[model samples]
Structure formats: C-alpha cells, structure tokens
Target: MSLLVVGSVAYDGIETPFGKVDKILGGSATYISLTSSYFQKNVNLVGVVGKDFSQDDIDLFKSKDIDLQGLQMDESGNTFFWKGKYHYDLNNRDTLDTQLNVFEHFNPKIPESYRDAKFIALGNIEPSLQAKVLEQVNSPDLVVMDTMNFWIEGTLDALKQTLKNVDLLVINDSEARELADEPNLIKSADLIRKMGPDFLIIKKGEHGALLFTDDEIFSAPAYPIVDIFDPTGAGDSFMGGLLGWLSYTNDLSPQNFRRAVIFGSVMASFCVEEFGPDRLRDLTEKEIYDRYREFRELSEIPEVG
Candidate 1:
C-alpha cells in the first residue's frame, strides 16, 4: 500500500530555551515523510518548494525511498520561511516571522502516479488546495486531513467544503473547539462530525490525544517526558506514524485505528525530545517497536472492580 502526503516544503528557524537554530529543512511534508519512511517505502510527496530549497533536502527524502515525482520546484521563487520561539513550557510558542514566498501562490498538482494511492494525507495547508488534491486522487481508500485555526477562522467556507470529502480530520483541541464553535471537546467533535468527516482526532499537546467516531471514543495519553526541546512538526510526525502503521497492516477497522493512535503518540513523543526533525530522521524500526511495546504495557490495566 502507498500513501500520498500533500503539504509544505520549506525552511524554518526555531528557538527554544535550550538554544536556537538557523534555517533548517523543515515543513509538514518533510517531517511526515521522514516518520512514515520507517514503516513504508512508497511515500509520494506532493508540495512545492523554490529554487532556494536545497537539493540535499531532496536527497534526504530520496534516501528514505520517498518518491519525489510529485514534488515541484519553482525556479524563480524562494521557498517559504518561518521563524518561531518556544516558551518555557514548550507547549506554547510565539511566531517571530512568516514569509510565504512561493507558498503564497502554491498550487499543488497531483502527479498521475499518485492518483491511485490507497491512503491520502492532506497536511496543514490552504483548504481550497486540500480540496483540489482530493479531487485529483483517482480512488483513495482512506482520506485524512490536518488543519489549523488560521484556515478555520479565515476560510470557513473553503474548509467546510474540503471537510466534506475527507474521512478523518485531525486538529488540535483548540482548533476543534473553535471550528465547531463549542467549548466542550465532546460536543465540539459531535458538531464537527455534522460538518463532514466521520472520524475526529483532537490533539492536546503534552496532555494527550482523543479520537471520536460516531459510535465510539478512544483516548490515549501523551508519553510523560520532562524534556521537550521543540514541538515543531510533532503533529505531522504523529500523522505519518499513524498512517504508516495503518497502511503497513492494511487494516482500517476501529481496533486497528486505536492501535495506530498509540503508535502515533509514541512517534510524537520522540519528536519533541529534540530540535527540528532530528529524532525522527534517525529512528529505526526496532526502536519504534520497542516504544510500542512499552506503550502497550503501560496502557494495559488490570480490572479494578
């Protein structure tokens, strides 16, 4: 099975209490492809970069067997760039700068080879663009989306239109509440289901993640860690791990979906321990399974009654 991911490919400058780093290869597709590469080899990336984007970054994806046929480079433009600084808690951050450059006019074109992908992940991007990618896909068995508050508030109509075509929607708890216009999470998810997607995954940074379906609800706790250097790309990494495991097993049942959530949580735990994309880049399959085993062990509880 193959998975298609659509999102940004750009440079980021990040600062934390520990220190700061200059421009680095960072983007939603970059982290997602890296994490997913551990479990699957046929990851098709769909996004645009600019002439300034390094070929070395492309080589990194190539080394992991990520197919870049769908990746486009704009010869005359510069890549998108973002700068941010993390707070002491690390969960909250302040954006220092954002330059959309090429991404300001990004129009993703789904390659012919990517049209038949079994799974499609619409990473955080303009809602209209997300809809365009969905329209391009010939037949995707599972379609999942990730979005932020910016689009939800600024492009409600576009976002709602895109939501109708996706099977799963992943967003942070705050965005979920804002989108649904409900303060309570459960109620927010219920309201969102009315909008479109059948499944909703609300990510609560450091607290945990919650999954809601029409018939069931599953909750998974975040791996408790004392050190969190940077939270960048954690959500995309989680999505990568979740879809990677699901595609690898070829199982879409609720039971398997719950397991995928745990796998995603574990992968995200590793993501926050280091700076931009460091932890995910060098992860091995054995290491991932080891963390999975520990998660299963810790999550299991004997009967209290």
Candidate 2:
C-alpha cells in the first residue's frame, strides 16, 4: 500500500529532563513517514524545506524508500525552525522559538506521480493548507488529519471545510473539548462528529487514546515506560502506525480498526524513548513485533467465573 504524508519538514532544537539536542531531523511529516514506512512499502512525503535542510536528512528519507517527489526545496530561504523545552513531566513544553522560513509561504503542490496515493495523512498545519492538499489528490481511500488548538480557534471555518473532506480527525483531549465547546468528552465527541469526520480519535497523553466511530468506541491504553523521554512527535507517530496498519491490510473492519489503534499506541511508545527521531532511526521489524506482543499481553483480560 502507498501512503502520502503532508506536513512540515524542518529542523528542531529540543531540551528535556532526559537531555538536549541543538538541531535534528524533526517534523510532523518526517516522523509520520518514517514510522509508517515500517508497514507500508511506498511512503510518500509532501512538504517544503529550505536550503538549510540537511543532506543527511534527505539521504535518510531516501534510505527509507520514501518518495520525495512532492518535497519542495527553496534555495533562497531557510528551513522552518522550532526550539522548545519540556518541563520535568515531559508532558508540558514551551515553544522557545519558531521561525517559519520556507514554510511561511508553503503551498503544497502534489506531483503528478503522487496524486494517486491510496492513503493520505495530513499532519498539523493550517486548515487551508490541508484542504489545498486534499484538492490535489484523487479521492484517497482514507484521509486522516491532525489539528491543533491554533486552527480551531483562529481559522474555524476553514477547518470545518477541511474536516468535511477527511475520513478521520485526530486531536488531543483539550482540542476536542475546545472544538466542540463541551466539557464532557462523550458530549465533545458527539458534537464534533456532527461537524465532520465520522471517525475521531481523542488522544490523552500517557493515559491512552479513544477511538469513536458513528456507532462504536474503542479505548486503547498507553504502554507503560519507566524511563521518560521527549514527547514530541508522538501523536504523529501514532497516526502513522494507525494509518500504516490500515493501509498495509487495506481493511477497515471493526476488528482491524481496534488492532490499528494498538499498533499506533505501540509506535508512540517507541517515539518518546528518545529525543527527536533518534529512537525511530534504528527500529527494526523484529523489535516492533516484540513490543506489539508485549502490548497485547498488557491489554489481555482474564476470564471470570
């Protein structure tokens, strides 16, 4: 199965209680494509970067067999840059700096070769940009999108327009509440479903994730890890796993959907083990399967008399 991921591709400087890195290959598309590559063979990336984007990162994408036909480069500008520091809990982070150089005017242009992608994952970006990308693709089999509070509060109408096109919407607990203007999660999920997207996944960091369909709901618990690390890109990684699993099997059955959520949780558990994308850089299929079995064991229920 082939998958297309559209989002920022840039450099990130991060600090956490575990450690710090000046700059590394970090972006929503970067993490999503890399994580999804484990399940899907042909992962496509669509985003813009500047001259400052490293050759090493490009080579890394090439090594993963990620199609970069839609990855645009602007020689005159610098790549988007973000710097942040995580609090002791590794959950709360403060954006110390943000410079949208090449990304400031990013206009996602899908190459003719990439317009037929079967699965599309729209990372956190302006609703208008997400909508623009959807316009270029030939009706994808599945469209999953991630959004933040910024778009919900600022460009609501555009967000709703974009939502009308996607199959699934992924957001954190707070964003779901804010978007629905409801305090209770069940009510929030119900309200948001009316806006668009028959399927929604409300992510609660460390707690777990909840998947809601028009008729059913599934909750997957988070994998417990003793040593905490950076939480950046974890959500994108989760979406990658979920989409990757579904794309790999081309199945949307309720059972498959439940398993996909587990796969997503497994990928996210590995994402937070290190800063940036370092941990995912060396993940192998055997390691992924091993962790998946462990997750299964964690979620198994015992029979009662």
* Candidate 2 structure quality by residue, lDDT tens digits, 1-305: 68999999979999998899999888899989989988998899999999988889999899889899889989879999999999998778999999999999999998888888888999999999999999999979889999999999999999999999988999999999999999999899999988888899999988889999967999888899887688888998999899889999999888898889888888999999998888888899998989889888888899999
Please give the CA lDDT of all the candidate structures. 0.89, 0.91
Q: Which ten residues in a row have the lowest lDDT in candidate 2?
A: 219-228
**Error in Å for residue 250 of model 1:** 1.7
* Best candidate according to lDDT: 2
Model 1, backbone clash pairs (residues 3+ apart or across chains), number: 0
Q: Model 1, stretches more than 4 Å misplaced?
A: none
Tell me the lDDT of candidate 1.
Answer: 0.89
Clashing pairs in 1: none
For each candidate, give its TM-score against the true structure.
Answer: 0.97, 0.98
